[model samples]
Target: MGRPRVTVIDIAQAAGVSKSTVSLVLQGSPLVKGTTRAKVVEAMNELGYVYNRGAANLRQTGSKSGIVGVVVNDLTNGFFAELAVGVDIVVQSAGFVQFLSNTGESIDRQREVVASMREHGISGLLVSPARGTDPSDFAPLVEAGIPVVVVVRSLPGGKLSSVVADNPSGVAGAVRHLVSLGHRRIAFLGGFQDTAVFHERLSGYRSAVTAAGFGFDEALVVPSAPSRAGGADAVARALAVEERPTAAVCFNDAVAFGACDGLRSHRLEPGRDFAVVGFDDVIEARTAVPALTTVSVDPQAMGRRAGQLLLKQIAAGGVSSEAVMTSVRLVVRESCGAPRLAAQA
Candidate 1:
């Protein structure tokens, strides 16, 4: 027969304390003296006792579970990975554990994971929503009074807190910098037009182009996957135009690298023959062969801020539904011919 289950009563008996004392220790209550708490923990450890947090959470009404759910569209993306890590750093430090889920950009998978997290009784949630996630999709969580902090992308018409970078201003700055470097024929590459991020960045690109006294040529804007392969495809299309672009501002770093690869395939050296700029300024951007010039969003900082916001909402026991637009900046490097221009001066 299997060994009998070890109960809190068993721990209490071994520790020579009351069951109430054991309960206080399990709840991490400060009211329990340090030495007494230590004794209870030691007794539980010796007995190989595992605390069932889920069961304990069910017993207490209106009590914090000390768990936060974090869901991201694509965990494989370095940007999203860093964002999750940032959220973990803050949440862990605040005595909370995070239940992380990857949706791989599937709305259905996102819903499943979010539902599973709800079943686990998470106090709050941080979500980088998948494509086509409607505001109504989160209505249940809102109705249940669970706080949610959206990151990276915004869900239209949702009364939920969100943390997003200034895509418009960042993309505009990239365009302005390229124009300053004598890139008269510039192309916007990568990212599907359906996404809010794509529209925001594209709007900035158009405004910057018009502001620079250049006609907005629709032919120069190529839509593709926001990945390396997509960037390559977009660049090929941009080059096929009657007025081939001399430089391009890509959707993100992955697309920028793809553009560089595409340029090389055509026997053109990036930075020397064609300039390229990317957004996100991912970790690899600095270490890449040409050192990509891009807009910096600081994904980790965004995650930390998002975590803080979620925790704040959890403490208040309600959603603030605030929208935070974080700032971004341009990071000039070799890929955009900035270093070469500097050397000439």
Candidate 2:
């Protein structure tokens, strides 16, 4: 076997200090006295230990590499892109560079990206998990003492900190607006059924539909891929129902765009022929022909919040189990056939 790898613990033993002290020295903490820091540095130098840093880099509670990993399941989504920009804005200001990886909703790709990031000595990790990814997928990172903050998705019982939008309230408000506008049958359109986010948003749709003195129609609940194409296909299915719905609350802006495309293919105009409201007010929402009406989840703000929280956890030298739920609002635009009000949202 090759010679054993050197560790911070070995450096601590050589320097006659506790492992915590070695960790503090590695972290460049001001709390470590100059002399102690010097001694630890001398020990590390003498042993030629430069954080060859396997999971061992993570072994030290607060040691950092000045880099963080951000893994998103679907980078193609503009909302996720905006969210990533938000994360970069915060982390860059804090002197940490972000390593971003897109998994394309592939669990294997997610695993590969995470492993690569870990090997690169990422001080912390921020992730929006892919579907079918178990909470346990994060166990190794946690065990290695890496601070992890999940964004846009919650890992129930994952013992990890998370930042997510208030899905139920956002969708409920959007549905209420639709109901108030004299829409008798409003469909909830386009999203995969497996995700917690989908269920949460669907729950809001159901609550609002039933609370507005309307029976919840299961036929109006259509699950799709949560993509533009998925939205288009879902709309076609909705139109095929015996009693077709007049309006829809889409899973996201992408789906909303797709729904509009689908409507056009059927020679139906979105604002004139049917009403559509979507979540995640992406940049395209404002520029679309009829301008999309959507729930403003402010993905960038959520990204910044996630980045800030992870930095806090890193500095605190422990795991943060805090669950931060950000608020949302409905932005009325033409797609929903809502009149331009005094002010949007």
TM-score of each: 0.82, 0.82
Q: Model 1: how far is 133 from its true place, Å? A: 0.8
| lDDT (Cα, tens digit) per residue for candidate 1, span 164-184 | 999999999999999988889
Model 1 RMSD, rounded to 1 decimal: 11.0
After superposition, the stretches of candidate 1 with alpha carbons farther than 4 Å from their true spots are 1-57, 60-63
The window of 10 residues in a row where model 2 has the poorest summed lDDT is 50-59
TM value for model 2: 0.82
Per-residue alpha-carbon lDDT of model 2 for 50-105, expressed as tens digits? Answer: 45344455566666578889999888889999999999999999999999999989
lDDT of 2 at 154: 81
Q: Candidate 2: where are CA atoms >4 Å away?
A: 1-64, 340-345
The models' CA-based lDDT, in order, is 0.89, 0.89
